[model samples]
Target: MGPLIPQEIISLDWNLVIAFVVGIGFGFVLEASGFSSSRKLAGIFYGYDTVVLKVFFTAAITAMLGLLYLSLFGWIDLNLVYVNPTYLWSAIIGGIIMGLGFIIGGFCPGTSVCAAAIGKIDAMVFIIGIIIGIFIFGEGFPIWKEFHEAGNLGSLKIQDIIGISGGLFTFLIIIFAMILFKTGEWAESQFTREEY
Candidate 1:
């Protein structure tokens, strides 16, 4: 009864419009929250400011809870939802590369694009680097295709993997997030920096 796009309740064109609007809103929020600053992003790694961790945890938990509630209420069909297939080795390699990029460049792809939009020279350079990296990846896909396709685990959910209900897994995630939030607060106090 939900997932308007897949259900054809909303046309493809309108879905794209909605996506654009959401993207704009998200970018505005990020910029307003000082995510446009590379220093602010890098602060997470240095234990100076953990706003990134807090915000991310909040968003993830909120989304998970919201989806769970929606499905329970029959507003969304959880079975109709798509899950990305797990490619273990590629996923790990990709995450490691992305983590290194975030640590060194001080911005993930999304924040880098938002910062670049606001005329940040460093972010602009980072975006260019991203483009170059993507191009290289595209060109070398054949060479790494086998490795990328390795460890093919079909679409699996955390709840299924752990043999728990979605509700229980989400509740546990909330608890974990709470712990991280407390740790982040402590880290912020310990690594306060006046510059950024």
Candidate 2:
């Protein structure tokens, strides 16, 4: 009825197996969708290709709405769902670092893995960097542990905080997406090159 593991409908082994299956599906989709190319991804910023924007925003808003609907239907209790706990300063600083990494490295952990699977040398290097970064984080967790634990707005709901119904909020999101989609289409026509 809810998240299977939390509801005890699925055992941990079943949960892990499902996660692996989902990951495989996700990776296959991304690779097939051309997300495996860093150039293809960075095009979101430049506007030559809107595949990244289209896919990302579509996935995000769809999931957002789906969760809202699930909560409304009493299928998934919103209160029981895990929200990413906030670490305010860490979020800001980490976001900046992550943005820089995205700009320079051109692949995030997911996309890098996707590209790596499809045999891209750059993506393979990016995955190696991610592994090294993970190792460093494990080694240095004590140093930033305090900051990471700082701003715990535990499982906060944006809808509750903003005092707006999720339906209305989703409407606003759809409007914004329509505008962005139009602009992206315009830019793609304007900026597309023969080379790419």
Candidate 3:
């Protein structure tokens, strides 16, 4: 809601309320999708289950298509949508750490919270680790401030970066997703786990 208040449709006051409602809805969806199970959420890395990939890929495609269609129909203004500025070094390092944490702990931050809400011990421990990490980062912010701010590339869209239209980019992504889906299916069959 920080940047969204400037947009046409939603106002400042309702932003927090909308965010709270959407967050709850998102958590419910995650729980319903079996993301509350650490094994299920971690299965993507082991190749036994591909539900995580399928769900996330579907979500990305749906959101992209929804926004594109909404813009076309004048239901939403794409120009008004906020894009976060890229801090390349920070992003690369953060992604690596996050990925490692996800693989080792069997829960990403959001999924950990979702699982913890439903009384998962592992997820609770993971959340505690996350809090510790956050505290460390906050306390050591000054020391790593330069590295965190390094490689500023401004806000970028994939379509803009690749010199293609947004629609064409989305189409290519959809095709890639189809291929990935098939690959995920293959992986699941090849790496079937009895526990999963």
Considering every candidate listed, which one attains the maximal lDDT? Answer: 1
Better of 1 and 2 by TM-score: 1
Q: Which pairs of residues collide in model 1?
A: none
**Where's the lowest-lDDT run of ten residues in candidate 1?**
4-13
Runs in model 1 lying further than 4 Å from the true structure: none
The residue ranges of model 3 lying beyond 4 angstroms of the native Cα positions read 1-5
Taking the tens digit of each residue's C-alpha lDDT, what string does model 3 give over 52-136?
9999999999989988888777777787788899999999999999999999999999999999999999999999999999999
C-alpha-based local distance difference test score of model 3: 0.91
lDDT per residue (tens digit) for residues 27-53 in model 1: 999999999999999998999999999
Please say which candidate is ahead in lDDT: 1 or 3. Answer: 1
lDDT for residue 171 in candidate 3, whole number 0-100: 94
Cα lDDT computed for each candidate against the true fold: 0.94, 0.84, 0.91
Candidate 2 lDDT at 132 equals 93
Q: Return the lDDT, model 3, position 99.
A: 92
TM-score of each: 0.98, 0.90, 0.95
